[model samples]
Target: MIDTSMGLKDMSKRDILVNVAVLIGFIILCMGGGGIMGAITRNDFGDRSEWYKALIKPSFNPPNFLFGIVWPILYLLMAIAAFAVWTKTGLTKEPIPLVIFFIQLALNFIWTLIFGKAKDLLASLVEIIILWLFILLTIKKFWKVNRGAALCLAPYLAWVTLAVALNYKYWELNPNMKPDYSWFVLKTEL
Candidate 1:
């Protein structure tokens, strides 16, 4: 976009190129954030963990690969939605929507840790319910800023809703299971 009052029609080629690059950068940044966290949380590689394999899961549980596939797509959509909101209000103005977005994203990572890493069924379920609510709050806030941005989060909300149910099922199946936290506390040699 043109820096001045001129319309897009007046944007110079360099300005257009820079804008495109910046947009791409935003997408990469957002998706990369999720990719890093997802890697930290997932446990489906190399014959899978015996602990996870033994845990009773719901009949409707999805294949592990499905998670690897679905999350990236969802992250991409979230990135696009965030970019849309940023385009509307920049970073400083209309900060609530973006703040909610980050909060939800953080909660997302926390749920994975509680469920996947820590193996705390009850905690994961509770955390996910909060995450789902925050997702809804984000959608409502994004709607006030950009309808398109809000719509982009719909699938995410749906996925998290499914997750909430799945986590509940896990909790029911593993009521007495204690969370493993030996890995959670970092061990280091001084």
Candidate 2:
């Protein structure tokens, strides 16, 4: 007597909505983290070409323009990967995997602050190694849940490895360089 076909249609629609919501949340979390950190640093990633160019850098350091192109794509991939895993883990129900995911994300933001904002090359180099480890751990945990999700983090891991090398190079090249917060601050003299 009941309308079984209608019930199935409603269920499919609900499932689709849930998937879309998860994807959107992941994007917001991933991109928003970068956005907030970049804002806190006054858009150093995009606006500091002159300052970065003046610094002594290694031969392998990519042109300043390359970063602006790469980061958004990486962030999007990362978000999709996390969402893939989260869906398998049942959102808030899976605690450990989610914890590892968040830990890595937090470390990611901290690395940006240390390297780009604080300009603490030596400290950032150390922190980046730790960040890389956490990322590896996150990927491992994600693999047990979803292989695709794990693969998504592979590029991120590779990029962080390069970042560690770059950080070390910056530290090695500029031994006596000091953190210059003045560059980011606005001065008002009467």
Candidate 1 at 145: error in angstroms?
Answer: 1.4
Q: Among all windows of ten consecutive residues in candidate 1, which has the lowest summed lDDT?
A: 41-50
Cα lDDT tens digits for candidate 1, 31-132? 887777667865622137676777788998888778878888898888888877777766686688888888998898777777778888888888999999
TM-score of 2: 0.83
lDDT of 2 by residue, 1-190 (tens): 1112344456566676777787898899988887887677655554454545556888898876776677777789889888877777765566677688888889989988777777788888999999999999998898898888899889889888989999999899988867756645888999
Backbone steric clashes in candidate 2, count: 0
Task: List the candidate 1 regions with Cα displacement exceeding 4 Å.
Answer: 1-9, 12-18, 44-47
Screening candidate 1 with a backbone cut-off below 3 angstroms (N, C-alpha, C), the clashing residue pairs are none
Q: How close to the true structure is residue 154 of candidate 1, measured as C-alpha lDDT?
A: 99
Best by lDDT: 1
RMSD of each: 2.8, 5.3
lDDT of 2 at 73: 76
TM-score of each: 0.87, 0.83
TM-score for predicted model 1 compared with the true structure: 0.87
CA deviation > 4 Å runs, candidate 2: 1-11, 42-51, 180-190
Error of 1 at 114 (Å): 1.7
